[model samples]
Target: MSAALLPPSLSSIFSSSSSASNPYPLHCVSPPFNLAASRPARSFLLGATASYSDPSDLSLVSPTSDLTVQALDQKLLTLLRQRKTEDAWIAYTNSPHLPSPTCLSRLVSQLSFQNTRSALTRAQSIVTRLRHERQLHRLDANCLGLLAAAATKAGHTSYATSIVKSMLRSGYLPHVKAWSAVVSGLASSGDDGPVEALRLFKAVTRRVRKFNDLQIVSNSRPDTVAFNAALNACANLGDSEKFLQVFDEMPQYGVEPDALTYNVMIKLCCKTDRKDLLVFVLERILELGIPLCMTTLHSLVSAYVGFGDLKTAEKLVQAMREQRTDLCKILRESGSEDLVENDESVFKKLLPNLTKQSDNEPPLLPKVYAPNSRLYTTLMKGYMQAGRVSDTVKMLEAMRRQDDRSSHPDHVSYTTVVSALVKAGAMDRARQILAEMTRIGVPPNLMTYNILFKGYCMQLQIDQARELLKEMVDDAGIQPDVVSYNILIDGCILVDDSAGALAFFNEMRAKGIAPTKISYTTLMKAFALSGQPKLAHRVFDEMLNDPRVKADRIAWNMLVEGYCRLGLVEEAKKIIEKMKENGLYPDVATYGSLANGIALARRPGEALLLWNEVKERCRVDKEGGKSDSSIAPPLKPDEGLLDTLADICVRAAFFKKALEIVACMEEHGIPPNKTKFTRIYVEMHSRMFTSKHASQARQDRRIERKRAAEAFKFWLGLPNSYYGSEWRLEPIDGYDSDSL
Candidate 1:
């Protein structure tokens, strides 16, 4: 991106141009004034060649002579050809002479060849100055095309398109080569520009067709390259039908399909699993006597493997090998015979350089196309997907045996096999493959260890997972990332080892590997399930205080569940309020947890209220197709959720709601336990008959509620207030009075 150096005299010339007011600095230099001024006017006239002027004349001329401009053009082209782009640009801009379109084209073409961002920017600026500032409307298509291509190569596809479209609107009718270049450039810019490339292709084609209608001869017709670029765009979008349609219309557009066109078509067919179309394409290739290139063979083999026709793929490989061997044998046999030794007279007539040859030097052999790592890996992936794991292993061995260096398996090649083995629950086999990878000098990467770590955790061998983590860090010298620590944390929680999980979490934070939301949620759930609600609350609070990590819905829900599990329903409701203040809302699991806890506490009315609120929120979120604030979106009710709600209703003595839940469960294709429902029903009737005991139970709950509320109020910064006098120290549920 280094800016080109310019001499002071040329700089002064460019300083006079109106473009000097432009904010952007130019990469090209201005021309010398003396070169333009000293050249005679007749030198630029008819039939007289212009001479390159000297820098000494850089300050001698005004910006008025055609002779001076022609001399500068000659000097600029010479400098450009010599790769002195900066000097050429200086001459182009400041020679007191306006450069011709030819000079502009060559200047841009040479600038693009520099292949640097600075060079491309200079080219773009030159085009802009010529088109607008200099009022050069009749600049040749070649110059504009080169500028567009330069922009494209710099990854400015949109700017390139605009340049091309602007040229078209100006009645320039850009050459087909320019259209093809722009379209292909856009199509190859990953997934971002394929649609635009196709759109441009269509526009060019329509314009070309209109020209034909009026019988006007124009080179604007989309050629094979243009259509092939559009076809490639179709392939990128995975539009198999569009690929076919484009291919079919090639003949109508008078664009003959070449090897590249067929290759892209074959790739499309294979990707879409259109085996029949592949066969037809192959037949056409043979009919046209077009020799298949390496890409063609690779595509065909990949297609067959994808089609589960391994036998045909193997035949193709075998045929290729035989062809190579036969070619080698013929070459060796032909090299063994020397015409000079057999006929001395013919040798005398031979060229002197060919008459003598060294026997030590072997004859050159033809290069054979061989499978590389990418091709082998593609086949291996196909085998893995087809459940032919053994075939995948054999293919790896075959790749290792190839004579070409590229056939050697890299990290991806070995990892793919291990990953497949891991997926099959064959951890031991996967380990063996990993060992082989190391033995062959292909060092296993962090991804390899992570895969193995996941496998061990999936098998519930947390101890082994810990060992693998240490091995990855200490032996491999690769630092474990957040994912590695998260896996271990989850494993510890899965086995009910909350203390171990907490230790890992702390270690993760101490290492400066920030704990993600999942990390916090996992520990919170473990603490809650282990009946350590206090520790769970501490985790939630710590998560809130950490500025780096934001507490998501899952983290909030886990905290609420921890409080609810301890029968501290009031604390749980406070969490819901806090979440609302933070523009968050509880999800279904939050309500389910609250319902279970409330029902266990014998508070049916409160449980029903939570359930109805959850149901209504889920409905609103579903109907509106949007969520308010940071509220979590509604989740569809599963069988487990319905069962939890039904149990809560039964425990709350809401018989009608309990029956409704049962009906809803059945509607969702989950059969309710009729026997359990009947037993609950009977219990409800018996409880109804014991009116005195039920009254006493309600009175006891009222007293407990009053005590808990006064304690909460006293704790809310009113210890000396009159309302605090009613707050007597008393245990509510299983917690101590102070614990509230």
Candidate 2:
């Protein structure tokens, strides 16, 4: 984000607000997966949580010491007065006379009352102690500011307030510089923070009469800063009346609204949910004698959208057209028509320019058109999203016409289109696109790998994706991110290749990319779907025990359903309880499997009872309600649902579960279609006596037994009185009487 993008608070976070401080560095909060030649693998291990020791859970080092906190305070106070908390923080920490840890805590409290500050735990306690002792440092407002900053950093809010109150009572009035820091901090905290911070500024403003903090601390007259802070507060609060009142009062108090002031008010209008109110504001701005800029116009259009006033939005767009008619005529005459034939699209191209002027670029802010990479990519993405391959191709052609060969879709552009193709089950097209990207000299990024990996996995082409992984490593010199591994492993799991998935994981570990939530989840899914609850159990246990890596809820649920499938209700219940303890919830697929599992365990009564419970919880009705405590069991899976379930089982090669699902479908009076029957026949044979592992079959009798099992599964799903429904399709020559 740019500095101007911030209303004083976020300027610092992006290292442009008055000074550079990495006070609250933005953590990814998600997998920082880069299955490319970017990040060093070591960083991955660092981000993962190994254990949760409270003190060790966060950074404990400070940039400065306490003894010189007095000097640091002076510099900090100066920095704060300049609205430069980022720089101020650095100075405060570099001091030898740092606040004692207790004093540091007190300081945190004071800083938290700022408009956009988060709370820090250690800072809050210290601030509380400082407030209680009344030993708050009077000299270094810097110390006080740092303390509050720390509190906010730690997410401790209450203590931050007390610290602010302590500062106010101490006769320390702040100037725009000091106030801006607080305001920015509060803004960053949340939208509500700015509102509350404004009230605090008002209280301080009121106290100015009794305790002239500005005159005491500085050698200058009051500037427009305090008013700006108040205005910012009101703007974010979105109380138009309050904002106008503040605006009116600004002139009375010898202040004037600058570009920032107007920008804030306009943004408020943009975010306005009320069309009439926004229109009223637009009219009011005109009445108040301020010229409307494109910024104001955009805000107006945004407000119309908020109110769902497309007519008004169209009218506004038309009005903008009238204003830019001369420019549009010039563009048409200049022969740029072929590049963007659509006038509306051309207008869309111009809006970003108006919004994204350079800070140093004379703030006249001309009607600029800055089309970001996303806009073009979105058009391409739109075609891909709709599953229109031809349209997607057209989009690529359109992009080529608009941009130079040196400029093509980057990671996002390629990934979005590839992912959609993969999801649509169009592996061939996806591959072609990848090839096209490479041909265009736009080397594939990690996103490219993820897309291809997912597509290959879906098609059971695990070996191809693996080959790509090797290319990514040895050839591309890229380390596979956790997501890349996850997708590939998930594919392996789907194909019932636990051994293969495990080998990849070991490869992943050797390459130094530690497993993540998805990794564990995919492994768990493999075990659950493969009728290996033991392996699933071990994977689940490991994930839950480690706080550093989150557990995959999908995988856990799969295990619970697997347990239920094998007639282990107690074990399923135990896993369910464990999931609850971990704050995870079971999804619909998990419940469906469990319901079916319950019926097959010879507990049709329990299955019916549980099905109703699961249905009510999921807010999805299950067939018809049961009788008794529960009447009918929900084991009768619908054909559509069974087809989907079967597809999942077949993809994973879970023949046992797939056969069971077929039985469930028939029980519901749903007949298997041709596609499903073919899948069953092909996959059953593959599992029993075909595919890569066919030679592993024990004997010819084993193959005959497999055939018999398949036959039993088929006939059991057919109507009892139907022709040949009870016909034994297996070879009877190898039969044991006991098996029958």
Candidate 3:
């Protein structure tokens, strides 16, 4: 067909001008395959929709059928060469029979190269179709590996797993890149993804071993990259046992552990709380003569900083600064030796026992690495975490003064300083750092401005936050993302500006920025706190309608809080029931809000029921059947919730329940506000038994209430006395007797 007469989709395929810009150009010296000599060239377009015929069945292979199959195959190939993968997929699926394996493989390769969700889905479909047709063996190993990589890159790791399994079943040991991509993908994936990655690693090792035992010469054995990915998974999961098992197996495969391996092991140590083993990693690296990389150095410094041992972290950095090679010796001779002594057995079990070095052995650290911007930022983060704002500023200044260009601060380094100042409520200093970023040509990014927005919001400076957001757009030309709007919404909450919060939320949607779960919950919080429970409900409904955001436990709790804040106990209860229907049980915040609502509604019986549910989830001490700190429960209650419930019980004269709550608090290491309870007791129940009751049953109930009150007073270390008289309850000698 002529170019002007061709459809738009097919027109691009024949546009020879596009070949100049095509990144994946066809390097064929001739046409891909032979066409029939007598077939008329005019049949190319007309034969596209010709009657279907099975290419595998020779009886149906007429000249016209052959022409149609060849025409479709050639079209698919041309589309792939032009990088029109989507259109190529459409053409492939519309064909009556499978295209030639070469054309099919090219189509799969091109689609996989796109690495988009839709493209990967199509690639997976092709792989599945090939398997169904029993022609999977036709695809080359390189093409299969590309499909696996694409599936992994698109976050469909399970699909990648199936592709590898097919490759293995077909007697093709997958290439290293194929299985390694799957491993790395699962390792970085959250939740049980790391565990599955580790499992896949073991499966691959076993398969390789089986091949070896059968005398099948296979080069597809797990290599260093594969082992590192598995080890990283172990680190993420804090599975020290699996980490050691995998580390010990590396040598059997003739794979030497590299610096990245040791770095991952360092992460495992920090994650598993074996900070004492940090030095032993370095020791083992030295004994094995592994060349140290900058990442390993960064890991060592970060580990110490993570453990809050700033003195040791500083000493290590200072040693590197002075080019001293005695870091291990210095650490061993210093107070860290005591830490090692305390965890000696732990270190031995986690790592191989270090052999005593002979006198001829080289120094423990062969070379000292100077700190880079990343390493310096890590140490500065330690200062930030420790609340030493001045020291963090000093570290940034030190980075600027360093002569080594590698040590000069980057955007991350500057952001750390801003984060520190923001945390310390030093917004002015934070802005100064931002100005410096622009002055030095390291123009502030969205994250830098977001931090400023958060700082302003936290300080209830909404007008300032607004001005910053405007500057971030108009001056910096950076649009506000979901996080920026979420921060502003929360700022509106702080200033009790619910309408303002809604306006920002609407504006965010108007700009096509999807609100995350945080945005919805923050806006709900604004409405809840502003006493507009119905508006909060509307926001919650909108959040439910949003396909992108899922309603998590926090979102449900915010809805419940909205109703509970207005003393709408029944509505809150209904929401909680709905929350349970969604498979989310009430957490501490849910119960806390309910407790507040019950108090506001003066529903003491509801408080008692809520307490029953909470008590069941609270850990019980075996000693006195009280809640324990050592044993974690399914729902550990915070002090705010427990205190709120206890106050309700005290006000309603549920003295025995009040005593139980106070005991639970003490067992959990939370000191009860005895003075507050005592004050409530005096104010609400001062004349509890003064009135005489005509009915004997009523008098007996009064006696029980009086007895329980006296017991509660005794627990609070206050002397019980008749309240109708001038005498007042007095604190015992040991009690501080201060008001809460």
List ranges where model 2 is wrong by over 4 Å.
1-372, 403-408, 414-440, 549-553, 577-590, 608-740
**Reference-based lDDT, each prediction:** 0.64, 0.52, 0.75
Runs in model 3 deviating more than 4 A are: 1-66, 82-105, 115-176, 189-193, 199-221, 342-346, 353-362, 466-486, 497-556, 570-586, 619-635, 713-740
Q: Name the candidate, 1 or 3, with the larger lDDT value.
A: 3
| lDDT value for model 2 | 0.52
Give TM-scores for every candidate, taking all chains together and pairing residue i with residue i: 0.45, 0.44, 0.75
Clashing pairs in 3: none
* Model 1 spans > 4 angstroms off: 1-74, 77-83, 90-102, 128-138, 212-218, 306-312, 322-740
Per-candidate Cα RMSD to the true structure, in Å, reads 20.9, 17.2, 11.9
Q: Residue 578, candidate 1: how far off, in angstroms?
A: 26
Tens digit of per-residue lDDT, candidate 2, span 1-740? 12233233222222331012212222223222222223333221111111122222223245555545456566656665675544544443444443444334333434444434222322332332332333334234555555544444444332344345545655545444544445545654552567767666666656654544544544222346656666667666766667666666665446655545555655564444432233334433443456555555555454444445444444544444344422222312222222333323212221233222222222222344333344445445545655666666665565566544433556567776777778788888887877877787777788888888988888899998989888888976777887898888889987878767766655565454546667777777766776768667776765564433545567677788668667677688778777766666555565566655654565544543453454344232343544543232333334444565555444444444455556556655777564665555555544444445445546643554455445544544532222554545333565552321
Clashing residue pairs, backbone N/CA/C < 3 A, model 1 = 29-89, 29-90, 30-90, 31-90, 31-91, 31-94, 33-58, 34-57, 34-58, 34-59
Model 2 earns a TM-score of 0.44
lDDT of 1 at 404: 75
TM-score winner between 1 and 2, please give it: 1
Instruction: Give the distance in Å from residue 717's predicted Cα in candidate 1 to where it truly belongs.
Output: 44
RMSD of 1: 20.9
lDDT of 1 by residue, 1-740 (tens): 01132223323322332122222222212110111223332211001011323222233335566776667678877887788888887776566645666777788777766766656656655554443333445356666777667667655565667777766655566677777888998888654578878888877776666663633535667778888898888877777667766767788777787777877777676566555444445444544556656676677778777777666566556655555523222322333432234334211221122233332232222345666686677778778877878888888888888887887888888987887787788999998988887787898998888888878877888898888788778877888876887888878877877767776766665464556667778878878887777778777776664433457878888888888887888888898889878877676677777776776576767766765765665566567745564545655556666677777666555544555566566655788765665565455533343345457668665454344333432433323232625544545356443311
